[model samples]
Target: MNAAVLALLLCLASAATYATAAVAQERLARREATAEGGNRSLLRTGAWWASAGLNAAAALLHAAALRYGPLTLVQPLGALTLVAAVPMGARAAGRRVASGEWRGTLLTLAGLGLLLLPASGPAPEETLSFSQVLVVAAASALAIGVLASRRAARSGLRHAAASGLASAVASALTQTVAVSAGRGGELLSARVIGVALLVLTFAMGGLLLSQTAYQGGLGAPLAVVNIVNPLAAAAIGIALLGERLQGGPAGVALAAAGALAAARGVLLLTRTAAQGAAPLPQARARDRSDLVGVKPAPAPESATVS
Candidate 1:
């Protein structure tokens, strides 16, 4: 097969794998949330570890896709994870996919496609200095701290956004290291080693944060992560890597519109998820009352007579 076809297949496979892993992680999260004492020990759970393994496999598939295809093509296809996830999640929960979720997923994908399709080709070969890497790391940490603060109402969305930022920074750093190594720079130098360590730290941080994010629900949080990941990475490319969007002002306008659309989609998704979740306590309470054989008191005789 041609490179493009191979890349497309690989990307699709990667999306499916990611969706499956997300379902597994969300299941684990839900169990932890409802469990007594809330052990929250994901590391000890075989399913969590299995999900992590799936994520690693998906990453390998995605890497192979990138090797065969350009970023503009591969990156957008990555959004298909949300598409695959919605139905998969619903099926796993023993429910039909909600219309709102379908709408939200499509809107998110459309917006993302608009946002990414206008991108110019590969970025210039670039490397961040050690100091620059430190600066980037600090900024990412600050952003994550702000989003992941306890005051956040939507814990899943907040954590997903933070995870996206961390993953983006990690991607930027990985690109830097790769570019430097490709150009025959010192791969074993102290600076390189430091950046490599930062990459690992951010990557793992993103993973753990995502695991937490899945506790709320699958569709919205996953969409947020996928949306934020590419946008943040693009921002880094523009600000630090000398990258620019094509078509100048027109391109900028298009990107802005796309951003707005993507935001709307995320809002719709979160609202729907929130609405769905709002009655859980009452439902569980009713279930508990039934279990205990509780019954409502009858009306007074006067009231019944009236």
Candidate 2:
């Protein structure tokens, strides 16, 4: 097979692995409490570790895909993780996949394909210098700090959005590191070490935030991550890596439209999140009418996007 075909297959596999990891991590988060060390306990859980392993595998495959394909082609395919997650999540929960979900998945994939189809071609290899890497790192750090400050104690969307943004910057940093590594320079060099540290920081932050996002709900958090990761990575590629997308102004317009369509599809899928998917609200007042000593009522339920 040609390199292009191989790259496509790798991208798909990476997406599938990422989907599996997301499902596993989200389930872990949904069932666990935050007081259990704010996602740190996940390190001890067998399921969480297995999911992390899958994520590691996916990252390796993603890097390989990048080696053979343009950023525009590879990053857009990452959106497929969301498409894959819906069915997998439904099946795991012993629920039937909704028809609207199927439609949404198709729409998301179709729009992503349209957005990326014109971007066909192999990307030229480029290595970033230490200064460039430092700049990227500083920018990502600033974004993460801002997101962290804005996160509320009870808002799942805030947590998830923060996580998604962190993950997006991490993705870009990963690309930069990968490109630098491909140059086969001294591994212990300051440049490589600096970039690697940034990658680790954002990646871990993203992972923690993503798990927290499950506290808010499944589909919405996942949707935000899926949307932001690729867009951020692609933007970095265009801005820093000097990769040119096709069709110039027209391509930009098409990408914007396609992004909107994809976001809509994600919204539709959010409607399919399991009943009571979000975190429970604060407990309510006890009912005085109970014969036995009144017990506080449970918090109200959360609804997925309607």
Candidate 3:
């Protein structure tokens, strides 16, 4: 098979693995308070641990994709995790997704697809100082991730912010790797240094953040962290590195539209949590008692939405 085909397959596999992990991690997070002595629930159930494993698999698969595809192509495709996570949540729990959930999912995927399509290249690749760029990016990422971690020491939101920041840096670096590998026409060269730095700085940071985020809330943090990562990378690719699409202004405009649609979808999904939107089958009349994936128990059923 060709590199592009290989890259596509890797991207899909990574999405599936990451989605599965997200589902499992959410279950563990819901049980956090109830985990007596603050012991790990997933230690026996292996939910969090399994999620970590799946996340690792995803990072590796993503690396393989960069080896063969353009960061421009591979970076946008990371959005597939969003597509993967929701349906997987539905299927694993033997639950029916509500119309709102379905609508949110579709809108997200539609907008992301538009924003993330691979632009066939017609322009010469640009090059810059390898070590200096990598060093700067790495130093910046470390500072941000560390500061976020420290500031968010006791807050779930802080941890989420830290994790999300790291994840985004990792994703951008992953794409940078693919670009670097391609530039040198060899995996190890001066051109490849940027890619290596991207991995060292961002991907490494992502791993640490993933652990913390998965410990908190699965759906919200996963969605936030994973989504932010690629958006950051794609933005940097276009703006900082002068990456261009072959189809000119129309392509750029369409890409912008797609991003807006996807962002709208994300905002709607976020409101589900923020505005006290009912989650899953509890809101649905036919929900079963034996829901497979776990989440925090509902506030009193009698509790009124503000």
- lDDT winner among the candidates? 1
TM-score of each: 0.81, 0.80, 0.70
Q: In model 3, where is the ten-residue run with the lowest total lDDT? A: 283-292
Q: Which of candidates 2 and 3 reaches a greater TM-score?
A: 2
TM-score of 2: 0.80
* Candidate closest to the true structure, highest TM-score: 1
Per-residue lDDT over 1-306 for candidate 3, one digit per residue giving the tens place of the 0 to 100 score: 877778789989888887777676655554554455333444555655666778778888887776666556766676677677766765554454445555666776777677666453322244335654566476656656565656546644445556656665565565555555666665677566646666666655565555455454344455556456556655555655676555678777877887787666756655544544344454332223323444546758776533
| Cα deviation of 28, candidate 3, in Å | 2.3
- What's the best-to-worst order under TM-score? 1, 2, 3
lDDT ranking from best candidate downward: 1, 2, 3
| Span of 10 residues, lowest total lDDT, candidate 1 | 278-287
lDDT of 1 by residue, 239-272 (tens): 8767677888888888888888888888888887
When 1 and 2 are scored with lDDT, the better candidate is: 1
In the range 3-102, model 2's lDDT, one tens digit per residue, is: 6888789989998998998888766775565334556666766777898788778877887887777676787888778778877876655455678677
Q: How accurate is candidate 3 locally (lDDT)?
A: 0.60
- RMSD of every candidate to native, in Å, equals 7.6, 7.3, 6.6
